[model samples]
Target: MKNRVDFIDWLKAVGMFLIVLGHYFGEPFDQFTQPIYPKQLGVAFFVFVMGWGLASETRPQWQVVYNRLFPMYFWGVVIAIFISLIFMLTKGHPAITNYLPFIGGINVLGNFFPSNPTTWYIGTYLHIILLWALVMRKVNVTLPLILLVLFCEIAIRSIFIEFERLFTGYMLVSNWITVFMLGMYMHQQKDNHNNLKALLIMVLWALLLFTWASLLNPLNITQTFPFRLPVEHSTLISSLVVSVAISTVYLSNTLLAVKFFSGIPANPVVRFFSRNTIFIFIGHMPLYDVAEPIALIFVESGWGKRAIIVFIMYVGLAVVSELLHKAVNIDKLKKHLWLRLN
Candidate 1:
């Protein structure tokens, strides 16, 4: 279990890095790594890791929710206010909406708060965590349940499209619950020597994803072929199939990663990123949004500019996150809060 925890930390480090890189470089990075969606894979790693960790949790459900969410809520409001203040000083008009609790304090309801767009994950995560705690965690992990969840996800997405409502970030619980459940199922499995089977499954999913990508964009003219999957082919079935395929491939690869790194110790840098992923995830985008214009002025080439921006955003966030962690001592805070509540 100790080694496995280390392995998951490494996985998170890699996932967080990919997400940060993808956000900074966007389609260009996606084009560079064709056939594999790095950002989506990163998200898959996170969702799977969450499910994996939750499988063995012995804490009360409310405790789990509080532990996972309180820090996010605290930091979200702080960042939102900070960004709003920056906007006020720079643009001469305060983003008054960001001062509100749900709109900016939590910053999780879709794109309602522009201060930090990446936090839609928080809302979706809240929904899925609640669902897991209230319902899914108690039920047996079975084929029928998985299929039902997948079908529900597809139906939900289709209904959203039909109603002309943008699904955005907040309402993605249905989209991601299947992957999360799969992670939990994998954690429940006792077999430790399933590397060959895992590899085979990964290959099959990769093939399916490749075939789907080829079919969707035969000419391969679009740079975001596999990663973005052209807007025209956004059918409900296609979207769900592609999403599941990508997630399966990543999940399978995660098993392979665990097998490969069985006895190895986690790298310090990787461990740092893994431990502070929430800070990096929440902090980097806003940092990038503020710093890019200032940093890009010194660079002429496209790749050079992106590299500079990512370097600054990542390193700067790491420093600030470390300082904040030291000052706030979130673990101690959570324990204190829990004691008071109890």
Candidate 2:
């Protein structure tokens, strides 16, 4: 087997692009495209990849957490402080609290700095990593464990609802943990594929896609679907179902990609996006805000306009992210910090 998987990089690039493109959509465009391409599916891809990549990790738990999270936390603080200063100068009131590390999610600064709300994934991702390192990694991949995790996730959400203290990051953890575990399961079972199993998995995946679409109904195509749950419970169940469904679809696609495309040489562009995903993911939103007005001046509101704007924002972010990636050298910084901590 090859030491590296090129298809995984391609998938990450695709996921990052989908997320950025999703954020660019507004109003009619979002409404039009959401049913066909839910942005949350991009997140599912990342979480799944995370699980697969880390399945065989042998590093100490704290070391793994530090290696994964510290660079993000470092850059997050820097960006948060910079944005806060900008707010001070422009809006004349900065959210001082945003300067603290992980005060909000380490990725987007916090709710106060809403420029990149998509960074909510940072907190959720961090929690998932912590959980996996501390607990999930120790367990054997089995049906019972998967089902138990799912049950615990649902139970946690139900309790959160009961208490009315719904932490978004924790809730998202509950939402995506199963997908993460499924990733681990996939890694474990990568060599066990057969025609019958593949066919069954595909069939189940199709059913999930249908169920997810019915639940989301982004187009409002049909308000009344059979087997709909009661109103109060519907929202919770719907979110979980949609997450699982979308994630499973991506999982199936991942299997196909690995099977067919893993040997292909990596595209430079896709590899760039994959490697710098976190940077671009965090930076794209703020850059989009700056690019949108200028882009709108050149085109009227429509699908064409949205595409143009997204393209401009994507290119601009790529340039900025490339520069930052070269200048900062996160790996070096992480090493320096690790030494100091030790």
Question: Per model, how many backbone clashes are there?
Answer: 0, 0
Instruction: Tell me the lDDT of candidate 1.
Output: 0.64
**Residue-wise lDDT of candidate 2 within 1-342, one digit each (tens)?**
346566578668877777777766634323222322445556767887888877878888788888888767776667667777877888887745444337544532222324445556667768788888888888788778877876776566454433334334233577577768877887743333355655666566556556655655533332111112223444665545433433344445445544433434567877777777776777676556577787788887777777877776666667777798798787898898899999
Q: What is the lDDT for 87 in model 2? A: 77
Steric clash count of candidate 2: 0
Worst 10 residues of 2 by lDDT: 221-230
lDDT on C-alpha atoms for all candidate structures: 0.64, 0.62
The candidate that achieves the highest lDDT relative to the unseen native structure: 1
**On a 0 to 100 scale, what is the lDDT of residue 116 in model 1?**
61
Candidate number achieving the greatest TM-score relative to the actual structure = 1
Stretches of model 1 off by over 4 angstroms after superposition: 1-4, 29-37, 92-113, 162-164, 188-216, 219-265
Q: Which stretches of candidate 2 lie over 4 Å from their true place?
A: 26-37, 95-101, 104-115, 158-171, 188-266
